[model samples]
Target: MQAAKKPVTFYLGEEVAMLKLQDLKAEAQSSWETLNLLDGTELTAEAFQVVMRKFGDLRHRSTWERICIQLEALWLLKGLENCDLIRTLAAPDTPIAQAYPAELLDAVLAHPSGLAQVKNGLQQLYSDPLTESDRICAMQFLKRISGYETIDLDLPEISLQAA
Candidate 1:
């Protein structure tokens, strides 16, 4: 008689859950290429939304943010130029700010389309005369993404005469 087969075992431990989550994220990232290949025809807004929601749920926010930046870059390079899609992916109000990786943010800021979006978003944020805390956060965001460049502001100087 043949030896008894080993018993099959399955356990859903924390490590197992984390691994599953990573697999999901990887799948989501791979879907980008498929979506890009369709030339914006097959990847309907609803489908895209579902993918975004899945990415949003993953605890690894940085991975999702990097994927978004790469997707935006690919779209721009391929002449897709879909500002609405980029806007939706990089919306300031979304979890992007929390998940945004430094390298990805830098890459996005370097691209013309991404830079334009960032500038526009900053303008909108400052349009309402931001409070001190808000201003600090804006400054930090700019500095982090823009490589700590100095911005010049024009201010008039007053001259004093001695009697």
Candidate 2:
């Protein structure tokens, strides 16, 4: 696919640094292309290394935080109902929950331990149960519990899906 072209001019103090900006952009594009060529596992490992250095932590928490940040970006880009979707998945009484298969609903509903705990507890809950989108919702809910400031729930109404 052809990359979209837009005029990007960077102003540095008193001068327009067009040539330097072009060089930087070219370097970034080359790096991105190289990364895109890696297999999934290799890419994930590389990403973990990058995040470990970026956060200055070797713990899993930093990697999880970075994942949540990416998920939040995806939600915002897709115009998902961040607040309502999170609430619906967490609360069993919501109308959306009413549409879920009864057992699946019970298994996937948010618990204090979070979605990972709920998934781990169920042995037979993996047959077309939760969509990838659904998992994303559950993940955001889980993250919000521990890192409440990470996901911005107070976005303007235009970005939110109707409940």
Candidate 3:
């Protein structure tokens, strides 16, 4: 039997408005600066070129369906199935990222490498002191990614205070 797709629910903060694509593009451009900084993918220069050629123009529209389709294509690319860069760009709670789709995010989390890459990328993005929008999106992304169970062990938190 065919499965039915559930409608996506967006969790927007009171102050966070869902801005239009032009605004999002401007926000992303100011925050990200370069596509290569999308360390989550670990995509080589050539692969990035391929992506640019394929989805570069189409992404301007930045609809949920379009993002999902692009992510599906990225999943097919050899050695890049776990690349969460594109999905990260669709971070939830931010109009800038278009709000990542749950189904696609689940598919990424299902794989071990995908989980790792996601964590790494999120950490890196969090570390960068970008725009306010970036910070909000990063936190939301972290919350969503942390819910999954992992074989990896938890490391002890480092504290500067006396033990």
Candidate 4:
């Protein structure tokens, strides 16, 4: 017998507005500066799948998805992701690093190395005092890293079973 299903309620929150490529492109054109940051993912399925496996899912996160074209758009996201010498762009005091997505942030904060790297990668791109865009980007960076965290935890675990 087939299982019966209950009616589902979909949550149409803006947080998820940019999940699709169309939404990301549409949302990106809101502002000239942001529109300039929008990048088309002209990736083939095989190539995209490979990139998906090799890199973090920062472009697909909320707020960021609508603003920056994942890391592929603005250079800053990838800079922070590198965290080698780029994190210095962050405000000297960075509470904003804590704004990562739930799952990704949880994993990162739990790992000492990951925590340090994320803290290091954060930056301030707008102004010395940190403009509103800077603030927004800060949270977006955290969320971007959090997407990486989600990717880490999401890796398929392999197992063998006998029937």
Best by TM-score: 1
lDDT of 2 by residue, 1-163 (tens): 9996653332212223222333433333333334444323344556644643654443454333333333222222233233343444344332112222232233334223333333432211222225555545554545534556454332222312226
Candidates sorted by TM-score, descending order?
A: 1, 3, 4, 2
Q: Comparing 2 and 4 by TM-score, which wins?
A: 4
Instruction: Please write out the lDDT profile of model 3 over residues 1-163, one tens digit for every residue.
Output: 9797543445433234445566544543433323334445454646544554554564556543344433442342222322235334344333433344555566565655555566555554455535666545556555555664332433232333335
Cand. 3 TM to true fold: 0.34
TM-score versus the correct structure, for each prediction: 0.36, 0.20, 0.34, 0.25
**C-alpha root-mean-square deviation, each candidate:** 14.4, 19.9, 12.2, 15.5
Q: Which parts of model 1 are misplaced by more than 4 Å?
A: 1-27, 30-40, 43-69, 72-100, 129-134, 143-163
**Which candidate do you rate higher for lDDT, 1 or 2?**
1
TM-score-superior candidate, 1 or 3: 1
Residue-wise lDDT of candidate 4 within 1-163, one digit each (tens)?
9796532322212122114455433433332233234454443446434543443453554544423233222333333343421332222122112122233344444544444444443432212224566544555454454544322122222222224
RMSD of 2: 19.9
Q: Top lDDT: which candidate number?
A: 1
Candidate 3 global lDDT = 0.45
